[model samples]
Each structure stands twice: as C-alpha cells, then as structure tokens.
Target: MATLEIKDLHVSVVSEDAPKEILKGVDLTIKAGETHAIMGPNGSGKSTLSYAIAGHPKYTITSGTVTLDGEDVLEMSVDERARAGLFLAMQYPVEVPGVSMSNFLRTAATAVRGEAPNLRHWVKEVKGAMADLDIDPAFAERSVNEGFSGGEKKRHEILQLGLLQPKIAILDETDSGLDVDALRVVSEGVNRYKASGEVGVMLITHYTRILKYIQPDFVHVFANGRIVESGGRELADVLESEGYVKYTGSKEAAALS
Candidate 1:
C-alpha cells in the first residue's frame, strides 16, 4: 500500500517582504484506504498544508520532510508531484479560458500516464466518467471551468480525480460552495474513487456536512497552525456541536461562527 508521510513540516510565505510562518511542525501519516479529515477554522493553515505538499511556489517548505512511499516530495516540481501519485483538488479551481475540458483533461492524463490514451477508448472513458458525475456531455467542449457554476467547477475537480486515479488525494474544502444535491453527487464521486482501497485521502473542510456523505476514518482538529486533536468519525459530531471554540478560543471561534 502507498503511504504519504509528513514529518515536522514547517512552511512559510512572503508577506510584506518578510517570511511569515504558517505550518508549525505538522506531522501526519496517511496510508492507502484511509480518509483523514482535517477540520479547522479559517486562517488556521489547513489549505497551506495542501498547497505546501503540492509544491505551491508561494509557500516555501523551510524545514521538514514529505515523502511519498519514501520518495522525497519536496524535491519534486508541482507537475512532478502529480506524476508521483500526489493529487490536489483545489478549493477554488482555476479557469482555463480557450482550452476545452476534453483537451485539458486528456493532456493532463497523458502527462501523468506517460502516454496518450487511445482516442477510441479515451472518448468512451471520458463519457462514462462524466455521465457518472451527472455532467452534461456538452461540457466536454466547453472551456475548462469557464462560465461554469460553483457546483460545475467542483464536479469537474472530482472528474479529474476519477480519471487520474492517484495514490494520494488532497481535497481542500470540496464542500465549500456545493449545495445539498451537489454535495451528495460530489461526495459520491469521491467515494467511488477511494472505493478501490488503494487511495489515501486527505479531506480538508471547516464543516462536517461533507463527512455525513463521505465518512472519514480519522478526524483531526487543526488549531493555530498545526493539528491539536485527533480522533475518529465521532469527533466530527463533537465539532458540529461545540464548534472550534475549544481550539481557536472563544473570540476567534465566535467570529467564524
């Protein structure tokens, strides 16, 4: 089984021409078939952990080691990380104007798969995946995420997830803008991808609603800059009831509440 191990990760970003630390010695291990829910308040550096692991240029990994099945992840480029079985589903997926979703997805698949998939089989595969997600067939010809609704964008993220089939997936607030039905469809897509029991998932969210659909094996409470508490699925119920007041203090938690 694949393993993504993070040890004493410290990350920083340039703010006001100075380095500002975000992640303060985070340590976590995710193995295949496990879903880890990272729950935290806003500005708690939850997204930072995802971006840092995916090698975002803005966030610098000052100290720590991230290894994918024992391979150094920090040494790889953003695209290299994807090819190395590390996938990141962004909270806000970007728009690629003028590039058709069909073209974009196939190119990405080619890069990751090391060769272009057969056109005959690729079309059928893409159609099947899109149909499973309740996506319109016309979307294949549309510019990537351009003029798409919040739900549409989120669905496409999961579409990529299903197609690429990476070893480890970092999903950043996938439930942020999704409505009740959209949330269910998106969650189901994620569930389908991880059903193989060979994928490790890091699901980051502030609310526990998504957990209702895609249950997590582990729940982690992130406070300040690192994980403060860890537990099982029941911990989400605790968070839903008490909120993050216990971790972020009453003042900060109240503002978010």
Candidate 2:
C-alpha cells in the first residue's frame, strides 16, 4: 500500500510571457485503500491538479512537491512515475491508430510492472477483467480506443487500472461522458480494483451520480484551484442535491435559487 501526497502544489500552463496559473497552492493526501473524490465546477482546476500530479508535459509545476509512498514523484518522468505505481485515467482517451488493445495493454503492463508479465497468466487476467466489465474479448483485437464510445473509453481506462495494479489511481473525470450502464460498469471496475486492499483511488468528477456506485472515503470540494471543503461520503449527496452553486458562488446559481 502507498500514499500520494501533494503539498502546497502549484501548476501553470505554458504561454509566451508567463505561465497561466491553474492549480493555486493545492494540498491533498490520499492513503492506500482509501477513495478520495474531488468535486468542483468546470474550469476549477480539478483536472489540472490530476494532470500536474501525473506530470503532464504541458502543465508546469511552479513549486511544491508530489510524493508517492515517501518517494519524490515530482522528480520522476511520467513513465517512471507509472512504474513507481501511479496511474491516471484521462478524461479524453486518445486513439493510437494501429495499436491493438492487447498490444497496448501488454506493452504498458510491461513498462509499469518493469518486467514482462507471464503470458498465460496475463492472458487470463485480461479475459477476466474484460468479462467483469462485460466487454467482448474481440475488442482486444481492435486498435486502442479507436472508434470507442464514451463509455467504452471509460471502461478501457478501468481495464488498464485492473491490468496495471498501480498503488495509486487518479481517475480524472472518468464518469464525464458515460451513460448509465457504462457508468455502472466503470464503477464496478473501480470497485474490483480496490478489492486487493493494496490500491488507493483518487477520483475527480463534477456529477455525483457515480458516487452512488463507488462510495467515497472522503469528498472534497475544489474551488479556485484549491479544496475549499472536505467531508465524508455524504458530501457527495449534498452536491447532488444543491449542485456546485454554493461552492462556486456564481450569480446565476443565486438567481436560480
């Protein structure tokens, strides 16, 4: 089991003159076997925080540090970070033409596990994971995420999670585009990944619907790039009832009320 720690972390997107600030001095801690949910209005830098932690090249860390299990993650390259037991499920999964799902999963697993997985065992694992998600084994022959629906992409991300078995999983908006059934399947995948008791999950989402399937250990409200409030799973229910209106302080929300 490992813990992900971020301290006074700041992030900015590159530009000509100066970097545009996105994450403004955010701090968070996630322990193994625990699920932390980050909820916020759009453009509140919730996704930026995940990308920065995963070391996305486009987001520069202006200051502070991110550590995993007491190791300095800020110093490691993205691939190194993955090998060090970190996985980020992207909001927009990219299609890599010509890369079969099996090939991609094998290559990524080899990279993340730092060794080639046992072929027989690996194949069985893949089949079981797909079965659990109700995905056809035939889908493995298709190119990675090519022509995949929104829900399929989300399920594929969870498939990677099951295969990789990272110590910490950061799911960035995995529920964003999923329909009801897909959302349930994806959430189930997440639950299965947690069954090992060796993995921790940090989930980011605007909607509280997914929370019904994947109960959170903690729920945080992010505003202006920082977490303004945090509580137990019930906070998710509050967000669903009232929306982000209280957190965002938007005039439109006030007017609607």
- Top candidate (lDDT): 1
lDDT of 2 by residue, 93-196 (tens): 99999999999999999998889999999999999999999999999999999999888888999999988989999999999988888898899899989996
- Model 1 bad stretches (over 4 Å): 250-257
TM-score, one value per model: 0.97, 0.95
Q: Please provide, for model 1 over 5-103, each residue's C-alpha lDDT reduced to its tens digit, 9 standing for 90 to 100.
A: 999999998887789888988999999999999999998899999999999899989999999999999999999999999999999999999999999
> What TM-score, to 2 decimals, does candidate 1 have?
0.97
The per-model lDDT (C-alpha) reads 0.94, 0.90
What local lDDT score does residue 156 receive in model 1, on the 0 to 100 scale? 98
